[model samples]
Target: MPPASLPSPSRPWPIPKLHLRIDDLHHEGVDIFLNVVNPKEALHEAIMASFQWLYTPETVPRTVLQILLVLRPMDGVAYTTGTQSHKEIHFSLDHIKRSVKRARDEIMGVLVHEVVHCYQYNALDTCPGGLVEGIADFVRLHQGYTPPHWKPTGGGKWDTGYERTAYFLDWIESRYGDGTIKELNEWMKDNQYHRRIFKELTGRPVRKLWKMYCSSLGDPITDGFVLVSKLIVKSYKPLYPPTWKGPDPGFL
Candidate 1:
């Protein structure tokens, strides 16, 4: 199975065979879930968000032949795992019940994170688990599915998983330019995970970049301004064009 294609609104992702298996039909989570999301569209939307944020049509992987989402009575939250050609997402119904007030947000957030694991590169499966989880949440962060509880700046290690790393990556892309993370991901496609990829992509290594990121907490635009300006200058081109501050719908 080849990887899925990169995303495009003109061509919706070819959603693979989607199957939902609910372990405890009587669980209160089931009631709440049925009250909210439709399994078909929910999974489709999750897949699209992953494709949209991480992969472009030319680069999206087409190998995932199927995605089976299992909503069962289990511990913790949710996780995705399977062979390269198939993926399974095991979500805890109890956790779903606990998130009843924000069921839609919580469900979609977890789904997006899990779906990313299905398609994202893992440096031949040697990438740090925290970084892997962080990448998943990074995609989730970009999907506009952030939980209301998520706060951007908290003094934590840059790779401190989940939203912390997601926000760090968000800042990295904002500083380096859009698709910088995608380039980082692509770099890992055939190579081992290396901190040097940061330098390769942005001309600054990860440590220095992280330090600059943290110091910029008080004034991000000022800190990011320099790198953004440099990218605009060095990366300029016609037809292809140079990077811009934030999304340039103008290009479209």
Candidate 2:
């Protein structure tokens, strides 16, 4: 279940119509996907994850009316596309086959990531591609579906996307408070992307936040002087690791 602050199943948020298209029924990945997950249930959980992490009942967008999941032989893991009212997620069956060892979790993670794209704001189509992808992965990270290879290490730019920026956003959420990222998302709904929004939310610039995040991770990106002496030889434990309260009843 989501925290008491978030909407519960009884007070369900709106869910778009979900449609699945399997382009190759005989593909081994198709069988793997079906055996590993119930499509309807998994899709429901993915949608709920977006709502739980990125929106409130009153604030959630209603523009997306349908989401079509297309499982086909593709080169990449997955990607999303569609009109304002409908979205299509193209998931790679080849990737599914490769992820057989953790099929259920991987499929759910990708679904959640792509579902986020269906509903997330994009700063009037001006948001940085990195931040856009970062927010999607941010929700995935919070949902506890993170891949084994993901880590919180920080050295590159903050908006490097994927788990890197997701971890940075997670750090911000921990440092500021819950709803910080939700507010960030809401800010992007009408405005163009700007570094100032980070300041508005946390009273610090995004670059500064990035530096602190890197320092916390023992990444030597601090400006000349070491930010944390303890991190010189050892990793500094994060003050607040992002929390995952597990799934609600019937969530999976």
Candidate 3:
């Protein structure tokens, strides 16, 4: 018998009943958003990004059975709400308009971030909010949709969240192993969130990791030593280059 080929990972994850609603068709933001992306495809791509990062094909989440996106005039950016099997993503049309200069990337980035919440295990809600947000953005960063404004500089406690914590995790992924973040997510599946998960993953406490990461970035470390960064390429690049703030899209 010939060696069987490995299963292709490109097999699509189970997508829910996808739906889209535009609160105001006349809104210029809606026009810009439509011009930038088709809703079904955008949502589908976001789903794929989440699945690719957080699960193997065999382990993909089957809980999400519906995803409805509401594009409306709202303060802040976006947010997701729903039961385990169904979720609604509310996007801010005003923010879309503001991001018209790079609407496609911004819209897609936010979608990917929110979608991760739909699927990621949250340590039964015991995970710190910052870690939750960091994982979301980490997925976004891996997807190659990092905003131009994002800087990799480290500061303000390790789990500070958003791009800052995402970058810190990126450093860990590069220095430790390829699936370090994936392992982090999987570890959270059945276990409660604990800071020691960092040590378990990297053999060092997160504080020490953050300290090293800060000093690597030319930022002051609390330990009174400035270790030079090896200048590791910002290659949070995934096994397959593709490609969030949190489950809640409070900030785009």
Candidate 4:
């Protein structure tokens, strides 16, 4: 069964023209995919998650005219590429086969992530790739599609990407209040990315915030950084969205 339905915006956000292409029509992965989900519904739902979380009708990007989904045999889970007006998502049949039992959730999760790339700004490509990937996973996490293996623990930097940074962003949004993440994205819309944006969003240095986040998790970082005891997190809610234990994301 699909885990849970992703929430849609109260009012509809405009959906771009969506198209689908299956390069390996004969692949068993394609059968699993086609049997489990409708492409149109899947894409629409993916766009819904992205638009609901990342934009409003008034601020949504209109430059995108089409989103084409291409399912083919490839090395990775998925990736998105396109011109200003057109976007293409290449998904791996091999990955789909590997995720057969959770094909619906896995496919939809990847779709939502790639769709975010179609719409989110990258500070003229100056944003860290980890942050970008985290934002995409943030949306997926919110969609109730978090894979079984995902969790919020430590060892790497905050922007280690994917679930690690996604959980961190969720904590930031919760502690600071709504719109902080949205504003961060807007700040990057026209200007080049700078660490100062984190300051502007949370009134603290990014490095400091990362330390506190590590502390909140009771992460054992004995390097030069201050070790915030795990007790501090006891009085507070989890850093991620409440829906999932690790919790949820940001943007307008």
Candidate 5:
């Protein structure tokens, strides 16, 4: 007889009801996704990553009750949307197909990014969009899901977003000590976002922090331009080409 299924391990944070919706069963990406991961396990791990990286047991948000994963043909890699109690992660099968060489890692990375949105605070809808995205990618980076293409360099504004802003936040956490990002996120939960928060957290203004970060990377800005050896336009490459507009409106 086959072995019995093992019991699920206990989780400190709430595990929302997980669901999956495949828009096209016949899509080639569907086969690839299935071959690579167990949906339940993958989603669970993504949630745990957000909790571990972004929140402590006492501070983890308990608002999310359900998370639905929708796989379909889409323009970009993925975007998330839903009410406070529920979230839907719409992942692109087309993107998955293109990432066949690294489907599992890419899928997990995207999932972790989207899942962070479900739990992250938004400064009462007043936080800069770039900072919001940076936090998501920050958690993804901590979870060890960084794509091979991602590199840590500093040049542009501190809130440039994605891996750029993520690396900046990572630097803050390293320099200021752990839980710095957690405190930053917590402050956003009940107050409006102000540049002063950085000062409050690390005894320095955000601009000063950005300058130090750039200097550490040996890519300080000069005359309002990032003085680097070469500028690498960061993108998901073939999946999110240069022509791609930007994040979906519903992505927040």
Candidate 6:
């Protein structure tokens, strides 16, 4: 389920020419694909998911004039890349076949993630690769397409990529305010990336925020940074600490 507070596509973004190229019509994955969704609608949905979550029409890039989805038999998953005016998405039929039980969700999820890459600012290609992937998954997560097997857990750095970074971003968005990620993305529009962007947005540096995030779940941090204990998930109940006992006052 998507968090209730996700932003919407209140205005129209530039609608690119959406096209699909199915490399194998006889593939088993094609059978499931045709059974589940209309290709045009699926592609359009992914586009809308990208615009709605990451931008308002005013901030959206109008340079993307077309998106071509190429579905072929390949290993692993999908990827997207192209010039400023045209984008190409290469989706794997093999991956779709493997995720057969949840084909519709998985395909749309991958499409959403890829489409995000086509439109998202890359800090002129200097942005951390993990943040790039995380922004993609963040759009996927907000689209209500997160797989059932996905879990929210901390493991490497804040920019660990994929769902790890997506969850961390969602937590930050929930903690500081809505559209926190939106502002972060906008800052990357015309300039190269710097770690200071996080501090500018949240009044704390990225490292400090990540440490506070780690410490929230009873993890100890060796790096003594200025900590803010006020930002809790509020969903995890404690056995003691009477002051912490309550239904989420923030959510209420």
What is the TM-score of each predicted model, taking all chains together? Answer: 0.81, 0.86, 0.85, 0.86, 0.85, 0.84
Name the 10 consecutive residues with the lowest summed lDDT in model 6: 237-246
Give the Cα lDDT of each candidate: 0.74, 0.83, 0.81, 0.78, 0.83, 0.79
Q: What tens-digit string does per-residue lDDT give for candidate 1 at 6-89?
A: 554665455688988988899999888878899899888889887877787667888899999998998788878888888999
> Runs in model 4 with CA error above 4 Å?
1-12, 222-252
- Model 2 Cα lDDT, one tens digit per residue, 1-252: 756773355545889898999999999999999999999999999999999899988888878899999999988789899999999999999999999999999999999999999999999987877788889999999998988888787764676578877888888898789999999999999998888999999998886777677767766564445443323332334322122222221100
Better of 1 and 3 by lDDT: 3
> What is the alpha-carbon lDDT for the whole of candidate 5?
0.83
Model 3: colliding residue pairs: 143-243
Report the poorest 10 consecutive residues by lDDT, candidate 1.
Answer: 235-244
- Candidate 3 on 1-252: residue-level lDDT in tens? 999997766555687899998899989899999998999999999999988888887788788999999999988888889999989999999999999999999999999999998988898888877778888998999898888878777555676677877888888998898889999999899998778889999999887777677766766544335443444433343322111233432211
Find the 10 residues in a row with the least total lDDT in model 5. 235-244
- lDDT of candidate 4 over 189-208, digit per residue (tens): 89887888898889988776
Candidate 1, residue 247: how far the Cα is off, in Å: 36
**Model 6: per-residue lDDT, tens digit, 1-252?**
867885655666788998889999988888888789898999899998988888888899999999999988987688887899999999888888988999999989999999999999988877877788888988898888888866556434677678767877887787888899999888899889888899999998887677666656545444435333434534421111001121221210
Please give the TM-score that candidate 4 achieves against the real structure: 0.86
CA error at residue 99 for candidate 2, angstroms? 0.4
